[model samples]
Structures are given as C-alpha cells and as structure tokens.
Target: MKEERVKKILSLLEKAYPDAKLVLHYNNPLELLIATILAAQCTDERVNKVTETLFKKCKTAQDYASAEQDVFEQEIRSTGFYKNKAKNIIACGKELVERFDGKVPDTMEDLVTLPGVGRKTASVLLGNIFGKQAVAVDTHVFRVSHRLELAKANDPDKVEQELCKIIPQEKWTRSCLVVGTHGRRTCIARKPLCNVCVVEKLCHSPDKIYSSRQE
Candidate 1:
C-alpha cells in the first residue's frame, strides 16, 4: 500500500512540476558548493542575488582560498551568519584545492569532509552537480515527505534513507527536485493549497482537503 502511494505521488508530482530542479544559480561544481553553503537558513533567491558578485570575486577554489576574509564576509553578509560562512568558504576552498586538486569531490563521503558541509549540502552536489542518485532532505523535502507519507523519520538522514528505499534509484535525485518544488508552490508550511494541489488525493495529512470545504 505504501509503495503504491509512493509511486502515485511521484507520478503526480512529476507531471505537475515537469521543470522542477535546483533553483540555486551556479555555473559549476565549485559555485554550487558555495551557493549551497550560502543557502543555509536562507532562500535560494537571496543566495542567487548575493552570488552575482560573490561568484565574480571568487570563481575557483584557489581564488576563494586566497580571498581576504573580511572582503568575503562583506560580499556574502546578506546571506546571514557571514562570519562563519566566510570562514567556512575559505577553509573549504583551501581544502578543495589542496586535497581534491581544485575539483569538487563527487562522492558523498568526500564532499561531507569539507568544512561547513553536511549531508544536505553534499547531497545537493551529488544530485545536482554530479547527477548522482541522491535525496537531499531540505526543509521542503522533510515536510512534504511526512505529509505525503513517504517518510516518518524526525531527522533528515533517516528521512533520506526511507525515501531512498521506496523511490527508485534512477528517480531519487529528480524526486528531491520535484518534491521540493511542490512544497514551495503548493504544500507550503503555513497554509498549503491542498484544494489545488495535484497530489492532494495522495497526501496523508488530515488537513489536505479541509480548506476546500470552507470555500
């Protein structure tokens, strides 16, 4: 029953959001790494705005590694936690240059080893940049997964694990993009538009169609 529901939900979401993908603007793996870091607790729109200048200033691992800390902080200050983010970016870039020869590591294990990068960020790089089968359980994925009965775990790692088990390996990365987009457009945190949601019938939330009756 769960497996059938998962399939149905995935199918509906795929149709509803055919163009769903990573919204964070990045030119390359290194830019994606920096964008993901800047995206923490911040919206992708904001990150894109900040990265306009940030990317020009620090294009490569070597450029970021050699960038002045204060200057980098000021450039990305709008992303929040500027001090820590700047420090992490510099450290991560230096490590990327020294360890990976200025190339973003494709493996999850290697990507997570960098400073300020967690499973979420690594998953982004793997799924988006490398086209690897990875599930990135950001806030949207986390919420939508539970609401759709795709996962019941409290933590992102566990949720990602459950999703991986149910979703086909080939669809894992695309599923993240589709579901994340759905969450942003329909299954919003405060008030979901369940009445208009393409997968409303598949949603496990009790309030899925409750708002429709009020209309």
Candidate 2:
C-alpha cells in the first residue's frame, strides 16, 4: 500500500469515528482482560452481558482464582467454550496473583504468557491500558485490512506485521480501532454498505458494490 493512500484512509477513519472506543466495558485492566477472554468466539454484547454480573462477583485476580470451576463455567456459559474459558480465566487469575503482583502486565511479552491471553488480547491491553503502540488484529481488523489491501496475509500475526511496516508507529492503536469501527458499521463481513462508506472512493475491495473505485 502507498503511504499517501494509507494516510488518507486513516484520516477519513478518524474523521468518521472521532469518538471510537472499545465496545467492551471494563473498570480496569483486569476486567478488560477477562472480558477479552470471554469475547473470543463470542460477540461483544454477549461478553458484556456475562461480565455485567460476573464482574460484580469477581473483582480481583484472587477472586477469580478462588472461584469454583463448575460455578464459573456456569456463569459464563452464554459466551461459548465456557469450560476452556473458565479454566483459562482461573489459571490466568492465579498466575496474576502469583506473579506481577496481581496486576495485568503492560508488555506484550509478559501479557501473552498469561493463560487465554494471546497477541490480540495483549495488544488491546497494551494499547488501551499502557498507551502503547500495538495493532490488534481481531476479525474486524483482519477483514478490513484485507478489503482495503492494507494487508494481504491470512493470519493475524502476518497481517499485523505487514501493517506495522506501513502504518506509522504512533497511529497503530488508533488505526486498529478506527478500522474496526468501520468494519462494524459499514464494511461489514456479510454485506458491506459501500455506497455509504466515507472511504468508498479510496477502497479497492473486490467485494465493494456501488462504487466506481477499483484496485
């Protein structure tokens, strides 16, 4: 991708979603960490619904560590893959209490070491909590990046690597957030609303409809 086109797309995204923020609600990094875990293979709405009550009971790493596995699994059953999620969450909580003084780690290396925390989740924490420059390639980001021709890779890791090489370092987090926002609102997975998209003219997606632009 050309630097000029990338900058233009970014500028349009910022303008379109000036107030874009993480859809997952959380009071702290720990809550966000757990929420992100529940969010895997689940919608944000479902995760939020589960967390609304779950967070009230489990306020800290120690709380989760002490939670009974069966009970915890029942609590988050709506999020899908409850067994694995519960096990991972409890293990991660215990790890946090044992290491890092019960606080979520700021660095990617440390964060990814936790159970259920992968590069995507770690990037979200780093960007939102630690104010670090990291790109989180979720489903939305992956599709949007490919649709925009900003990344040609199938895997999230490779796509993130490709983006980091082109997108300015400081704008990594913002780019992810805004592009994700666009993906959710306009450039959706099933049927994109290309005609209403602000970057329609700039987009080169073969899936694009009602736009004169072509790659």
Candidate 3:
C-alpha cells in the first residue's frame, strides 16, 4: 500500500541522513528568522558564511532595527537580492522589536505576519527554534515529496497539507529535515540518481527508462 511505501521511504531516508538538521547557522530565534529570510534563493552554505560576521555585527532585533540600511545591504550583497533582503530584514526586525519584545514569535500565525516571513520560513522557525511540529516545504521537500509520491500537490502549502495528513505529528519536523537531505543528495531536481536511490521502486518517475539504461 501507499502508506507502507511512505514508511519505508522515511525509514531509508532517516537512516541515510541520520544527522540531518537545519543547516542555517543561527544562535537565537531572532537570528534564525533573519537568516531564513536572507536564505531565499540562496544556499545555506553561503548564508552561513555571510551570517558569521553579520551575526556579530547585529546580535539582536534592536541591533538590526537600528542598523544603517546601506551597511546591512553591503554586508549581505554577496547573498544576492541584497536590496530586497536588506529591506525585509530591517522591516522584520522592527516588527519583532515592536511586536514581540525583540523575541521571535513562536507561533506560525504571528511569525508569518512579520515582513518577508512566509509559511515556509515560519515553519522552519517553529520547528527548529520552538520545537513545534511543522514541515518546512522548501524546494528540497517540494521536489522530493513529489518524486517519492508522498505528495502530488503542485503548491508547497498543499504538499505540506498532504504530508501532514499522512505523517504523524511527531515526525513532521524530522521528516522535513530527512526529505530535504535526500533531495539534495539523491532525489535531486535534475538527473536524480534513480539507480542508486533507495526509494526508486516507490518513485513514480520512468522506472523502465532507468532500468533499460542500466542494462
């Protein structure tokens, strides 16, 4: 059945990516929020590299709120979309300071209300920072879920809902971590390694094409 296949896939992925966790480097919830915002269309590796000095410069929500926009933009320019990202960070920080007592809001509803914090970012903040059950549907989760047939939904929110319906609440956060790692390592968006994939049998991709090519 599909449910059994889903469990098998999760088990394999959990084994493969036993240490999978949030890659973005941040010390506090506020920092994580800002880092996730900056991470749009950017690699976590690049974000970590930038955040090394960036965090040192701006440690608190108040620090970011009061920081000069030009300095912040220049510091994060290498991450790309510096103009918009800088603006969002400043606006988000101000909201955090004014609305949440300089602390990152723990709930998805409040977190999404902050500038540049969408459902994906809010999920990450909730799961990683607050230990709440939420599946952050980034590109990795979106692609891998479809590849594994865990979700057929076209949109991230719908995919997340489908996954929630199947996966237990306790596993939601860890499932995101595992699936994201699998996407990056094996079930990549382009040219996925179907032959070596542990969940290849469960994947809906052209299995005959892969088998024939291997033969």
Maximum-TM-score candidate: 2
Please report the candidate that would top lDDT against the real structure. 2
RMSD of each: 1.9, 1.5, 2.0
Q: State which candidate, 2 or 3, has the greater TM-score.
A: 2
Candidate 3 lDDT over 87-141, as tens digits, reads: 9999988998999999888998898899899999999989998989998999999
User: What lDDT tens digits, residue by residue, belong to model 1 across residues 1-215?
Assistant: 87888888999999999999889999899999999999998999999999998888788899989989998899999999999999999999999999999999999999999999999999999999897889999999999999988899999999999999999999999999999999999999888888889887666587474544433
Greater-lDDT candidate between 1 and 3: 1
In candidate 3, list every pair of residues with a backbone clash: none
- CA deviation > 4 Å runs, candidate 3: 206-209, 212-215
> How many backbone clashes can be found in candidate 3?
0
lDDT of 2 by residue, 75-144 (tens): 9999999999999999999999999889998999999999999999999999988899999999999999
How far out, in Å, is residue 98 in model 2?
1.0
At residue 141, candidate 2 shows an lDDT of 93
Candidate 2 wrong stretches, greater than 4 Å: 212-215
Give the alpha-carbon lDDT of every model: 0.91, 0.93, 0.88
